[model samples]
Target: MPETGRREPGAPANVPAARPADDPRPSAPPELDYNGRRHRRAMDDATLWDMARRIPTALAQTARLAWSVDRRMTATILVCQVLSGLGTAVMLTAVSRALPHLTASDARTGLTQAWPALTVAVAAMATGSGMWILADWATRRLNPKIASAADLTLVDLHMKAELSAYDTEGFTDRSQAAEIGAMRAVDLADDAKTLTGGFVQLVSAATVLTSLHPLLLGVLVLSVLPRGLGGVIAARIDYRVHDRTISARNVRGMMRWWLTTSELADELRANTMRPYLQSWYRAMCDRVEGRELEGARPYLLVTLLAASLSGLFTLGMWVSLAALAVSGAMSTAIAGTAIVASQTAGRALNSIVRYGAVMFHHGLYLSDYHTFIGEVRSSATARGTTRAPAPRRIRLCGAGFTYPGRDEPALHPVTLTLERGEIVALVGENGAGKSTLIRMITGLTVPTAGSVRWDDTDLATADAESAWRHVGLVPQKNGHWPLRVRENITLGQPREHGDEGVWDAAGRVGMTEALERLPDGLDTLLARSVWGGHELSGGQWQRLACARAMYREPAVLVLDEPTSEMDARGEHLIFRELRAMARDRITVVVTHRLDNVRMADRVIVLDQGRVREQGTFDDLVATEGSLLGELYALAQDR
Candidate 1:
C-alpha cells in the first residue's frame, strides 16, 4: 500500500484533503498557527504579572541597599535632587512671565519688563547645575562601595558553604548568576538615583502644568504612556533572553576558556586541535547568537510601532496647545510655557520608565544572589560550640550517605574503626564510595543514616571547623595556586613557619630540588601568565600539593589518589614517607594501585558501596576468588 493511496488521487501536490474523523493522525490547533506557520508562544500571564509587581519592589529594595551602603551620601544626593527639581519649576515660571512681555507690540517696553524674569531664570539654572554636581560626586563614591560590599558578602557566603552545595545540580549556574547579581547590585543603586531624580522632575513639571490648566496634566500623562509601555516591554524581552540562555552562555564561556587558557596550550598544539576546537566554538556561538537575534527582531518591531504611536500622541498634544492659543483660551506666554513643560514632563516620565525597567531587570538577577545566599546558609554544616579533641580512636557505626535526589546511597551502612598509629588503605573501582567515606570520617559531611565518632564524642556534636583543623587532605586534582612556592606549601598553616620547616616538607615529597632550581627559589611565583612567573610540570605540581598536606601535620591525613599523576620515583618517595609518618597519626590512603596497599597496616576493599573484604595485604593476596586479588590481577595485566 503506497502512502499516497491513503489520500485523494485528485488532491493537489503538497496539499491534503480532509481526513476521515476516525483517522489516527494528531493535528495541531489551527489558531496557534499564523498564516499556516506555527509561531512562538507569547509571554505567559504569570511572567507578565511578575514583571509588573517586581518593578516597585526592586526599586524599593535597591534604595534600601544604597542607603545601607552609605546613609549620609544617600540623604545628600536625594536632598540635592529635590532642590534641583524645585529650581526647574522656578525657571519654568520665570520663562512664562517673560514670554508675553518679550512678544508685546512695543519692543523697548517688552525688554524693560522681561529682563528681571530672565535674570531669575539664569540664577535658577545655575542652582540646578550646582546641585547636580554635588549629586554626581556622591554617586561616584557610593557605587564602588556598594559593589565591594556585595562582592565580599557573596565570597563570605561561598567560603562558609559546605562541600555538598557544590555537588548539587544547577549550583554552579546559580553561583555564576549570583556573581552577575553582585555586579548589578551596584547598577541598582545608579538606577535608584536616576529614578529619584526623574520622579522629582515629573512632579515639579506636573505642578507647573496644572497651574496652566488641569487638562494639560492629562495631556502630559497621555504623552508618556506609549514610550513607557515600550520601555517596560523591551526590558522584559531582554530578561527573558538572558534567563533562557544561562546554560548556553556557560557552555560558550567554557569553550572560550578551553581555547585560550594556558592549561590546555600544550595539548592544543601537540594534537593540532585548534581547528576542531574553533569549529565547536563557532557552533556554540551561533546557537547563542541565534536565540538573542530571535528575541531582538520581534522586540525591535514592537518597539518601532510603540515609538510611532508616541510620536503621533506628542504631535497631537502640540496641535491642541496651538488651537487653545489661536482661540484665545490661552495667552502666548502660557502656551509657550506649556510647550516647554510638556517636553520636560515627557522626558522625565520616560526616564522614570526606563530606569524602573533597568532596576527591575537587575533585581531579577539579584534575586538569584539572595536565593543562593539563603540556600548556602541553610545547607551549611551545623556548627557546634564545643571544639573537637585530637583524634584517637575514630569509629563509624553503620555510617552511610546518599546524595540529594538519589534513591541509592553512595556508601552503604558499614561499621568500622580507625585507630591512631596505623595506616589504612581504601581500595575500590571507580564509584565505589571511597571518597564519600573519607569525607564522612573528616566531618565534611554528616552521615545520612548513622553516626561517626571520635573516641567517645559524636562528630555531629563537634565543631566542624575545629574537626577540619585536625585533618589534612590531598585531593586527586589539587589546586595549583598562583602564589610563591612557600605560600603554596604552607597555605593553611601560620605564616610563622620558617624556611627550614618548608624545606623539610618539600624534601619529603622530593620537591626541594625543584624549588631550589627556580630563579627565585621559594619566592618564585607559580603563575605562567605574569611576568617572572614560572610554570611547573604536572608531576612537579602534584609533588608540591603533597608537601602542602605534610606541612599541616594534622592528627588525621587523607590522600585520595595522591600519586595518580606522579612519576614512579615521586610515587615511591611519597609512599615511603607516608609509611614512616603513619606511626604517629591516623592515615587513610585511597588508591587503585596494588603496589601502594602493601605498605598499609590494613587493606579495605569496597564493592557496590559495601565493604566486600578487609585484611592485611598479604592475607588478601592469599585468599582465592577475592575482589582484591581480581583487581590486583587486572592492574598487573594493564
Candidate 2:
C-alpha cells in the first residue's frame, strides 16, 4: 500500500549502488579505463588475455548445462561428433590412395586400381555427413530444454526475492541483467555446440596434415594462433563496451517510453515535449555510440592485421605443399590431400575461435544470472517458517521503520492495536506516514525497532504466507491485469470461488450491473490490447479492485485511498459497504475524504510519521487545535 517499490519518501540523498540490483555480491574492484572511457570492469591487455584463457572452462560449463537438460541427446551428439571426425580422416586417406592409384598405370588398369579406393572414399563421406546431420539434429532438440531450465531458474529467484531488496535502485539493474542473462544462458549452450563441432573438425584436419607431413602441422598452428587470439580480444572489447553502456541504454529506453506510453502520450503532445525528449535521446545515443567505438577501435586494427597474417600463412603453406610435390618429397596425390586438409583446418580453427569468443561473452552474463539467484535466496525477507493461525487482533508495539541507507525514519515508534469488527481511519497530510502505517499492518514490511505481532505471534517470526492468507489490500494504485474479468478479481486467491462468488463480490461493490453490460460478462478480457477486450473507466477498475478484496474474505483489510477516482455516488456506496464489511473484520482505511472518516469507529491523526491525536471522528472534529480538527475544518472550507 505504501508504494511497494523501494521509495525513500522523506529522504532524497540515499542513492543505491549502480551495480546489478539483485546481485548481493560485493562489487568488483574498480575497472581500468581504456581509450579515455570508463567501463564496468576494466579490460586491460592482461584481463583480456585472462578472459581468453577462461573460454575453455566457460564452454565446459555450458556443456554441463546442456547435459543436465537431456543426457541422451548429449550422449548422441558426442558419439556422432567423434565418429564424424574419424570419418573425415578416413575419407581424406582414401582420396590420397585413390589419386596415386589412378595416375600410376595404363588407362584400363588405372581405373581398376582406383575403383576400390574411390568406393572407400565415397562411403566415408556418406558416413561423416550422416553423423554430422545427426549431431545437428540432437543439438537443436537440446537447446530449448536448456533454455527452459534457465528460465525456470530465473523465475524462482524472481518470486523469492525479498521486498526490502527492491529498496535499492541496483535491484532493478541487476534484475534486468539477470533476465537478459537468462537468454544468454541459451546462447552459451549454442556456443558450446559450435565449439564442440569446430574442435572435432580442427582435430580431424590437424591429424590428416600431421600424417601427410610434419612441417604442415607447424604451418597450421602459425596460421590460426594470431587470428584466434585476435578474435578473443575483440569479443572482450565488445562485451566491455556493451556492459558500460547498459545505463545509457536504460536512459534511452525510458526517454522513448515517455514519448510512447499511452499514459503520457496525450500530455506530451499537448505540452510539446517531443523536442525536449528528442534532445535527451540524441545525447544518450551519442554516449552509447562513443563508448562502443572506443571499445571497438583497439580491436579493428588487430582484426585487420590478423586477417592479413592469416592470408600470408595460408599462401606459404600452399607453396610448401607444391614444392614438396615438385621435388618428389611427397607424391602429387598426397600434396593435393594436404592442401585440402590445410584449408579445412583453417576454417575449423576459425569456427573454434569464433565460438569460443561467443561463449566467453555470454558466459559472463550467465554468471550474473547465477549470482542474482543466490542473492535472492540470501536476501529474502521472510525468514520465519512458523505458520500463524487467524487472529482476532494484531498489535504494533513501539514499532518504527527507516529505509536502508536513509538517516530519517519513515515511521516513528508508535503503539496501536487493530481488533476484529473495528473500522479505523488514518488521516494525514501527504508524507504523513499513513500508507507506511497501513503497510506495517499488512506485514508487507517489518519494523526496524520493536515488533508487530499477530495475536501473540511476532510477524517477523511468523510464516509470511499464513499472515498473507488472512489479509487483503486495495492499494493506492491498483494493477491493470491483462486477463478476463473473472480472473482479474481472483488473481491471487485460490480458485475456491466460482462465477457466482465473483458476481456476489461485484454486487457488494455495485459493479455487477456494469459487468453485466459487457459483451462476455465475466469472460470478457479486461485488456485493451486483446481483440474484443473491454476497457473499464478508472472508477470501474477501482470497483473491481475492491471486489477482489471482498472476494478474499480475509480477517484484515487495508484500503489506501480506494475511492480516489470514484464519483460521489460510487464513493458513497463503497464507504457504506465498507462499514458493513468491517462489522465482521478489522478494516484500516487511509483516506483524504473526511466524509468517509465519519463512518469509522475511531480516527487516528498522523503528522510527520507520528500519531498526533486519536479519538472518534466527532470528538476529534470538536477538539480545536488538534491535527484532525484542522484537517476536517480545511476540507469543509475547500
Candidate 3:
C-alpha cells in the first residue's frame, strides 16, 4: 500500500498519520534564556508579536481545557476579578479628587467635599476586596473538578485504545509521560480562569492609571518588566533542569510504586532487595538535586539581581511622585492615586511573571499531550460503527501485519481457515506470530493488507467491539478480573451471568470445589483486599477464565495456550469440556504441549509465520518426514 493521506473504502475515517519518531523538529521551545546569560534562538520579531497577539487566544485555549466541567464557574470568576478592577479604578479617581480639596482653604469644588469622596472610596475598596476574595475562592474549588474530568478522560482513553496500539515499544514511555502530564495539565487548567481574571484586572487598572497621568502610568508599568522577564528566564532554566532530572525522577517514581504497592510486595520480600532499592532511592535524590543545581543556581542568582533592580525602580517612581506633589505640580489626591496605581501595577506584573513560568512548563507537556490525544480521538473516530455477521468459516487471504516497533511483520501474509464446529490447533514456537494472528482474528488489530472474511463479511470493515462479539480470546496470560469468582467467570456475558449460565460455566471447569471454599460460593471475592475474600491457585484462575469464554459462547474461540498453568488432570478435564462445547462453534487452540495437541481435531504446524504442515494427529506422525514427526520422536524420548 502506498502512503496515501486518504483512507480507503473500509479504513477508519480519521486514520492517524503515522509520524516517524526521527523527525528532526518537535515544537519550538520557549524564548526564555538560561546559564546566567541570554542565548537568543532564531525567532523573528514578527513571531514574537504573533505570540503576544495570541496571549488572549492562549488564555481562551486554557479556558476550553476546563469548560467541560463548569463553564459558569470560569465565567463568574473572571467577571468578579474584572468587576473588582473596575471598582478600583473608580475608587482611585474618587479619592484622588477629594484629597486636593481637603488641603485648600475654602477652595472646594462646587459638586462635593472631601468627606463624601472618602466614604465612596472606602466603599469601593471594600467591594473590590470582596470580588478579589470571591475570585480566589472560585479558583481553588475548580481544581478537583478539572482534575476529575481529566482522570476520567484518561481512563477512557486507556480502555478504548485498540490492543494493537500496545505493539509499539514507545507506547509504554509515552503512556507513563501522558498519565503524569494529563493530571498536571488538568490541575493547571483549573487555575487558568483565575489567571485570566487577574490579567483582566491588571489591564483594567493600567487603563485607569494611564488616564490619571500617562507619565506616572508608564513608569509604573515599567516597574513590572524586570520581574516578568526574570520569571520567563527562570522557567527556561527549569526546563533544562527537567531534561537532566528525568532519570532520577523515573527511578524515584518507580521505587515509590515498588515499596507502596501489592504488585511488587511478593517479589521484594522474597528477594530481600529492600536495602538495594533504598540505596538506589538515596542516589536518585542526590542526582536529582545535582542535576537541578547545575542550571538552577545561575538562574536563581539572575532572578535575584533583576528583582532587586525592579524594586529600586519602583521606589524611585514613588519618590518622583512625592517631589512633584511638594512642588504643587500635582495635588495630594492625585499623588495618592499615583501611589495606589503603582502598587496595583506591581502586583499585576508579579502575576504575569509567575504565570509565565507555569505556562511554559505546562505548554511543553501539553504539546506532547495534545499530540497523543489527537491520535486517540482520530483512531476512535476512525473505527466508525461496526456491524459484523456470524460467518460459517473465517478466511484469511494474504493477510499481513507488523508491530509498530518491530522490523519484520508479526504475521506474514499467509492464508488459513477453520470451518465451523472444529477444534483447530496452532502449533509453533514463541514469536512465530501465533498470538499476533489470534489478536488479528479477534479484531484487535486490522490487517495491513488483504482481508479477514467471516463467510461474506470483512472483519476489518467492522469496529472492534462489534466484530469481537462473535469471537472469544483467552490470551496466553490468564486475564482474570479481580472481582467475584462468578463475575470473573461471566466477564463476556454480564447480563447472562444468569443463574443457570453461571452454574453451568462454574461446574464445567471444576471450579465448584474452589467456589464452595469461599464464604459466599460463586459470589466470593477473588482478590484478597475485598471483605471476606480468598485467593485462588494459578490453575484455578485459568479455569475461571475458560468458564468466561464458555459463557460467552462466541462463534469463534481463540484460546492461546489456555491451559498453560493447569495440571495434568485439570488440562484433560478442560479439553474434554471444550470438546463438548465445540459442537456448534469453531475452536482454535494454540499450545506447545503435544499431549493436548493430540486431542485437537486438526493440527496446523506453523514455523516462522508460514504453515509448514497440517494434518490429523496420527496422519502427521505417519508422514515420518516433517517437523511434527521430528518433534514427536523427541517427545517420546523425553
TM-score of 1: 0.86
lDDT leaderboard ranking? 1, 2, 3
Report clash pairs, candidate 2.
Answer: 21-170, 21-171, 21-174
Please identify which of the two predictions, 1 or 2, would achieve the higher lDDT against the true structure.
1
Instruction: Please write out the lDDT profile of model 2 over residues 158-207, one tens digit for every residue.
Output: 67665667775577777777787678765565567668778898899888
Candidate 2 TM-score to native: 0.83
By lDDT, the best candidate is 1
Clash pairs of candidate 1? none
Runs with alpha carbons beyond 4 Å of true place in candidate 1: 1-50, 106-112, 230-253, 266-308, 530-532
**Candidate 1 lDDT over residue span 1-638, tens digit each:** 11112346875553445656885443211111122211112232235466558777776766677788899988888899999999889988999999999999998999899999999988987897788789888888888888898899889888877777887877887887788889887666667778878888899989988987888888887777888788767766776676556556766787788788777999999998876566556655665787898898879977997899888888998898889889998888888888888788878877887787676566667777777888988977766767888789899999998887688999999899999988999999999999899999998888888999988878888778888888989988899899999999999898566989999999999988789999899999998776659989988998898899899988999999898888999999999999889877899999888888999999999988999999999999889988999888888898
Error of 1 at 512 (Å): 1.0
lDDT of each: 0.82, 0.80, 0.71
Candidate 3 residue pairs in backbone clash: none
RMSD (Cα, Å) for all candidates, in order, is 7.7, 8.9, 11.1
What TM-score do all the candidates reach, one by one? 0.86, 0.83, 0.83
